[model samples]
Target: MSRRSLARFVALAAILSMFGTSAAVMPAQAADQVIKIGIDLPVSGADASDGIPTQNGAALAVDEANAHAPKGIKFAVDALDDAVGGVHNPQQGATNIRSLAADPAVMGVVGPFNSNVAAAEIPVSNESGLPLISPSNTNPTLTKTAKYRTAHPNEITYFRVCATDDVQGKAGAEFAKTLGLKKVYIIDDNETYGLGLANVFEKDFKEMGGAVLGHDHITANQQDFKALLTKVAATKPDAVYYGGTTSTGGGLVRQQMGAAGMDPAKVKYEGGDGISDAEFIKVAGDAANNSYYTVAAPNAAKSASAQAFINAYKAKYHSDIGAYSANGYVAAQVIIAAAEKAIKANGGKAPTRAQVLKNIQNTSGFKSIIGTFGFDKNGDTTSPVIALWTIKNGAQDFVHQINVSTK
Candidate 1:
């Protein structure tokens, strides 16, 4: 059966008839089991542009999972907002995970796109043995921490389908090297993702034998970037790398870079996945052109599966897909796949939280719209590929692929 076929999932439903033969392993409340996957996202705030698409992709995955749910279990989603006033709040993210952990029905969670939010959410999720799978969190520290732990506990079960900032930032730096751009200035949004990405870029760019002019951090959602842009202009560097998202002043930085007389093409501009959203093009207008960004998800225009998702997404939401849509979809797929494996291992009985988490951590060769990928020992995707994009005509167009490594 085709993996993408929604009807194919109903085959699992057929297993319901066979469950009666395995009564010894069935849980006491098996008849009332309702499997749920919690979605924590910044659906209403600053990340709404990316968050909405992330949620849309996840919703589709949930629909498919339910269509294929095994007997005695009804699959559903318990989506919650982790945003406050349209911005990701670490505290809110933590609270959302705690609530999900408290729910007995929730089998796993997919969300908290922002890296800073994931940092807060991880500890809470680990405490309750809830596996938190992120569709967009890319800070390398989460998985790259010293053996057994970094800032988090050894029992942490956080995982991500997206490429971490170390890989993405290195791609950006390498792309800059190809452009022969020297003397680059770095600016970040002062958040976990942004700063972490900036640091990686700075290190990689310099290591590539390029000159690093300076670096600084900016406030999130600030309208005025003229002063910073002016400083960047004074340096007259070959490029300005802003490690931030559209919601975190990426557009203003792009716009002001142009307004400050920094030629978009000559000086060049680059950012990590944070600024790759359509909103960046909208917010920066003509100035967005010629800018560069890196994304973990493959280009939808090139992948057939991605094209199908794009069409379905447009039909359902009447909106174009975002950079993180495929990531979110795959995140849900991973969780659903793990749950399926756990269910089978339990002889058609519902699996425990630990079982589900273990299955996810050991996932390998899972196929999805973006392509086939699996989690390594660190709970990060085994795929080390990152796609680069360029802005043209107020849209992010796929440029090419870049293989990156993190030190």
Candidate 2:
């Protein structure tokens, strides 16, 4: 199915809608080429526990795409590992981007989950004109700020399905206030995502009239946060806010906090999406309770489509999905939509990079497993809903959701 053909079918569907009839958007054509959706992930090492689920989600989308693609529009996924030394590395991520963008078959990419990796790869992808959609990079500046435009000048190829850190940070701060946490200590793993989120949370908490006791930076992937926990315990904060992923010591921090004699009933634990995964509970063990988390996307159980996605994922991979699985799935869906539009618009031919990019930028009310959303001028999601959740009996339980507006 060429992008040019998609237009004719869409117009037909729209006309049918007026007549109170609608049609599913699927077309079959015979072509000799295959379009590849590149997926960059930390498939090996510590973060792989988090990144693998995202990869599995994207892979599921890829499989569905291939099954339904027009004979002329075959789709595939090229998943590359961006992890080195059991963690996310910006240099490795950048190298992966350079390689993926060099491939002619790759129309777009669907990963680089870590914000630090996204920060590293964005410029390289922009230079190569390869549009990249991230499932888990929540750093605000990636799209919500001018950092992309500042680096690329006339180009903007980076996009994300997750809410920005600022949104999650503000919401977490609000949750802290709601829990009567006036004094808090902030800590981050010093990665681009964690450190930036911590900064946003600290600033927002202060603005809400909460007192910030202090801030600390921890080494990524360190198992022993006992020394740091001991220091934080002395501050007598009402709560401790950690702005880092589970792979970057979130579990250790929580466990060590308990070891340091912090009263969870009073000294609550607040964190962003990094600590909101099932893996966190497995790692933190009994120390996972009394923790609250703010995530950019809702839990998969909240939607029928998302549940179907989970079922299909389990049916295929024989494992459960993770926190960012829906994110990766939606990101791939966005790219697939663009590919369809580009092919239909190009007179039944394979879509060009510019065509796909333009279509993605113009996507509106694109309903996926995650939710209905479209990119704004900055390639940020126009309708962003964040969720507040907490661990209950060894599971992440949702509390509430809020629509976060950039304005």
TM agreement with the true structure for every prediction: 0.87, 0.88
Candidate 1 per-residue lDDT over residues 106-168, each given as its tens digit = 889989889999888887777788888888888988777733243346665888887888778
Query: Runs in model 2 with CA error above 4 Å?
Result: 1-31, 148-151
Per-residue lDDT of model 2, residues 213-240, tens digit only? 9999998557887788889899899989
Best by lDDT: 2
lDDT of 2: 0.84
Give the range of the ten consecutive residues with the poorest summed lDDT in model 1. Answer: 146-155
- Could you tally the backbone clashes for each prediction? 3, 14
lDDT agreement of model 1 with the native? 0.82
